[model samples]
Target: MEQTVQPCPQCGTEIRTDRRFTTWCSACDWNVDPVEPDERPGHVERMRRGIAHRYGERLLAEMTRGESPRPRRDVAGVLAYAVALCVHGVTVALFVTGALLVTLGRGGAPSVLGAFLLGLAWLFRPRFGRLPDDAPVLHRADAPRLFALIDEVAACAPTSGVHAVAVTAEANASVSTYGVRQRRLLTLGLGLWEITTPQERVALLGHELGHFAHGDTRHGVIIANALHSLNSWRYLVAPIRNPSGLEVILNAFYLLPFLAVQGVMMLLDQLTLRAAQRAEYLADATSATAASTEAAVALQDRLLVCGPAEALLLRESNARQVRGAAKRDEPGQGLWDRLAAYVESIPEGEYERRRRVGVLRGHSVDATHPPTHLRRACLLARPAEPAAVRVDAAAVAAITAELADARQVVARCVLRG
Candidate 1:
């Protein structure tokens, strides 16, 4: 609650700061990146990060040069699709072989073996995404206002709108296709949603829906299923821990298949890596287009603080647990309200530090996304534009009211965790 002033160590510029937050020189960006780069990533992760950095830089340059960010049908894209097709082909072959053996063997030993093969086929079958059973599902009828906002964002992205919304306790949001019909579903994480402003919420929706508009092959049923099958294969053939003599011999037999699967998986990842980065950049642009460049860039800034928000939630949950359920259910102390306050309380200097850290460490939302700094840069590279879809105070209130019940459910889930 007190302000302090001192000369910056890096530069003798007078710096005014709050005691509650980090003190850094605004003039020279002294101590802008306070955190050290994490050294925990393995060799594979390091390699992937390197690739992401390279791709992000190149794509940013291209976009700055006035090139449209369209998905390229280049050699890597073609090869990746071919590999995905081959992966699916193996699944089909297994089914066909099992069926032939069962039909021709006439209930003999061959038929029994055929049944085993069929079981294996079923085990490795392509998986269509499914809605989480535990998550709170909000249908259009249940949340018309929220769905309307989502539809507005989807229309701005020019993609198919989501069929349903699923509320979760995580600090991230994502869109995916689910079930045999490939219906679009938007997973709205209350942790992130509650902290974002109305405009930033639109930007978040825009970025996710942009994946569909941008033709991100990784999210498609074909490639997604291929990746799933490969992961399953990898899990099956993985080396065992503390193996018995007989198990050691079996592991020796499994080693070749394990190496082969890993090789294929790496190949697929390498082939699609550039395209995935491109899709993310494109999605960021869509976010800017739908919610204005300022809103989109601000959304990225908000993302930098998600770690702190989650930490606050964890700390609150632990304290509440110590106080027992009676204290947790006390009125006027809603989890969402606390989360919003904590996020709003984050200092501007802290955000700048995180932004600089992201630039230094190549920070990303995940392995699949481009570095956040680059995404922010890409949005700012273009001229700032007005939002295509704006959420006024009335609309925000309506949407918030619609999500009230879901918020309580997610709040309980977080506290229980």
Candidate 2:
């Protein structure tokens, strides 16, 4: 189905999506973007009541119903399904050598193996491929700012390395892959710096470091890589045979095994995702405990508005930029052509669910973070604590330091590789 990018209900501007995640809107005071959320709580008082302990209890209970209650999905659903599909596909083939002999040729076995390997390669692309070498590293002068901020927070958090950081307006931060020792990345968007009060920004960083502190960052990356690899193997043939033009056909084939796995990895991924989500909650609480309630609330407000606004701005900006090229549906196209394009756009239920979670909740559950609204709800509902999230005099100094420490080592390596 062709989804007409709708206009933002709030701002009446068009909605847009790219790269499957929300970014920023330049027009509003709130950084706008999209994901999903419960219909607004009507008014502040009602929200306060609905999100109160009694409501939280009721909401929590309902939310947990039919949920694992005691499920474990360290690998998440898709990845687990991918793994199962791989095993079962191999087993079935082994059992029926006759079918293989009759239906396919010598290359079949190698093809399967090659597909699996391709999936595996993409899964760990970071480890083998040059790291996103272009990922911004804080400059030397900025290093003190980032480090000092990290260190101050590290007093509460364990050591977290600064492997890479970039500029985006997603209100996002991340920790890097796992090894003997853990390195981290802190991506700060331009909007994050421009709009947020220094204290709130620090609190946001603390929330990120808290993820590293809890060890969720490293674990999540492992699971994410595994999931990507499995998908690679399952969808290997389609990419080569038809590319994305027949993406729907490809994805259906890809999802067949996940359905059979009956949600093995789904449970695993949820557990990990919830862990990360809770960590953020604690981080928010930590920031509140460390700093002021205002900073906490400020962060939440900014985050809540970020998705919808970004979506709006993206549409407006791109409209002017790409108006001439917008594909008008051609009625004369054959079914195959229509099917090819439409299928590419439609994602599995799981992906759709994830998108809704981000839109409504600002989270893809398996992801380490949740949207700003849920966080604000949790924080505001609970008792308040005080910490500054640490916007020190050093923030100005950090500007220079973050810039000074930048490098291009990985970008160069990827070119050579």
Candidate 3:
């Protein structure tokens, strides 16, 4: 791999850059964000992004000015809950009706109809969250030190303890409830986890656990299941394209129900959007509280560069394959080490340029989250807080050792993809 040194266009600093990746000045960040945002979102997506941007800006302003109100169940929330209740009520009614028909109906036709209704009821049943079957699951016994760290962050977050941890190959981390009992589960993405410092790890945990502490309605069983049911309905009734004669008539018949389902889903999304955004802000505050303001902000900075990190991984995988060096038995060998080194090599100027790009693009972890810039601003706007949970080098080392096997598994998965 040959690297050429050249003077930066923006500044006279000489820098070395690999030809495979973007060539940018490390000192002046020249051409760091040369690519323009090319995604052209649809109308609904544009509207959603618009709403999020406005809300994020307003919230950031309010927080900075110390005028933000404590989140509570507002009209939208009440309406959302009522809609979710109605959704569940319909499912329950269908079940009851189907059961009665099946038990009491004397004729075969009635029994068949009842069975059909029962199937519909089953289709619309509330979905309890489940852990991904493929991801490596880590129990308390498997990773006591990691769980202990999570527990410490949980205490600092003042949230309920997580029941399990799952590791995946994504550049993100999240917490969600799973199963009938709704036990909390934390998903740690090695892409993000490997790059984070120990304190940033605490910030990551605190942010995830904060969803529980703040009672994020979007993740709550009621609203989540309702959204799931509505989505199922939408999928079930959606009209197909390129229909033949008979299918055309059926498609026309299905159109009304599809439209109705879409309307309901949109209404539910509108109701929950505000609450979800507020929850993110609150969660970020929790991250700051647990890991200190500086670490939380740094975590946001890391998030801004996740795109590049992922691209680097993809490039590495492709390059290895091209060189015929991607061994089956040792797939993704040294992948994590390479990724960590790449992240460490990113210059501060590069980080700053990415932050500015984030602001320009209203970049967020997802559509549900506020812009990364706003999140960072909100954290900086507040008074700096000391870390409530700390992780020393020994703790990090122990956690790393605990996740060593899972890391290998996830690394292989990433490379294989």
Candidate 4:
């Protein structure tokens, strides 16, 4: 017997039912007024066609922009290290040297030193990889299943194979965009693991592929670090000048000059972030293209709702604990804040805030990612998509692509394990 599709309550037409409790009849083009419920196959088909057509234009736009270039593994590594190094290097180099610059009243050494320090702190600040380190990092040779999916995404757009694909847990994932060479790094977090089916995972990966297609996979990282750098000079300087103890007293005496410099850097930071927001939208569009609109939507839905409330809360708490542990291990700190010149020099306001946000928001320095709800809604709006049951087309292409050479290089690293 043929299955009877449910019709919309507002109009008599075939429509897929949803757990969300929202129903509409696409066949009648949605009624101007509510209708009595009825079961009709013809009505169902018509409604289905209507809804499909209604969303079809939007969905197509989202899916066609698939494929992302993989970040070069070395480049990704460099960024991760460089950002951190930039912060430390400039802080020490500038601050120690800045004293002389300040003394000489050199043509703009103070400004130059301030600018460098700002950029350094910005690049190295913590960010939300929310995905854990323990998550599986799929190498080209290892995880044929996952590699096949990536290949398909690349075919939809020009791309080098991803440097890595990881699951933060059973449920969620993130793709890396920054670095020198083309590299895409995926992190599938625990939340993603818990709520989604394997089919959904492929769909989710497709969204990351979308980022590749739109060229959003890498540009923003540089931008984000740059903005942070712009702001951090204020952070680096305020601490050097004020030493944090009594802001009120300092505010009365030196507030004008402090605010003057801070205001300029703030403007620069704002300008940089404004540009970053536009880039984020491009990445979102990429998510829509490589995967089915529905799958993309569902994958995000699964991520937001999957993890327990406690896990979310605990994550931040745990992040704090981890930072404290790291600090204790460092050679200079000596398990105490004895007011060293360097420590005192780093604007105290930015220091603790950066640490807190790392654990709290996931990104230590810049909270660039959009909120969970907005991200989920954007993905969900694309509803109805092709399944992730197949990846053969992509796999074949990957085997022959130029990236095959790159894969071999990464393969050597994986082989060591």
Q: What's each prediction's TM-score?
A: 0.91, 0.52, 0.88, 0.44
- Tell me how far the alpha carbon of residue 99 in candidate 4 is from the true structure, in angstroms, after superposition: 14
Q: Write the per-residue lDDT of candidate 2 for residues 1-417, one digit (tens) a residue.
A: 323455555566665434343433223312342433456444533533333424333433433342321223355434544554454454345435544443454667755655554444434343322234445545324465666666666555444445556544332445454343444556665433434566767667766666565545324545555445444434443333455758767667656664543344444344344444545565665565555666777666555434433443344335434654353332211222322233234334323333334454322232345455555566666655567445657685655345432322322221222
Regions more than 4 Å wrong, model 3: 1-39, 67-70, 319-326, 331-333, 363-365
Candidate 4, residue 217: how far the Cα is off, in Å: 8.6
> How well does candidate 1 match the true structure in TM-score terms?
0.91
On TM-score, the leading prediction is 1
Report lDDT (Cα) of residue 23, candidate 2. 31
The CA lDDT at 263 in model 4 is 61
Which sections of candidate 4 miss by over 4 Å? Answer: 1-136, 166-172, 177-182, 217-221, 238-284, 307-417
- Cα RMSD of all models vs. native, in order, equals 2.8, 14.8, 3.4, 18.5
Under the 3 Å rule for N, CA and C atoms, how many clashes does model 3 have? 0
Model with the higher lDDT, candidate 2 or 4: 2
lDDT of 2 at 181: 49
List clashing residue pairs in candidate 3.
none
Model 1, range 110-208, lDDT digits (tens) per residue? 899888888878988988888889999988999999898888888877887889999987789988988999988999887898899899999999999
Q: Compared to the true structure, candidate 4 yields what TM-score?
A: 0.44
Root mean square deviation (Cα) for candidate 3: 3.4
lDDT of 3 by residue, 173-226 (tens): 998888898888999988899898999999999999988988899998999889
lDDT of 4 by residue, 1-417 (tens): 122357666666676533222233445534322333265436534543344333333433443344232322334334443443454455456555545655565657675775564455445453433323443455766666557666766665445557675543222455664344435676655334324444455566666655555454234454344345436555544634435667656655555655755664444333333223334444544444555556556555444333332243344335546666553323322111221222223332223222232233322122234434444444554444454344455553553352333333332222222
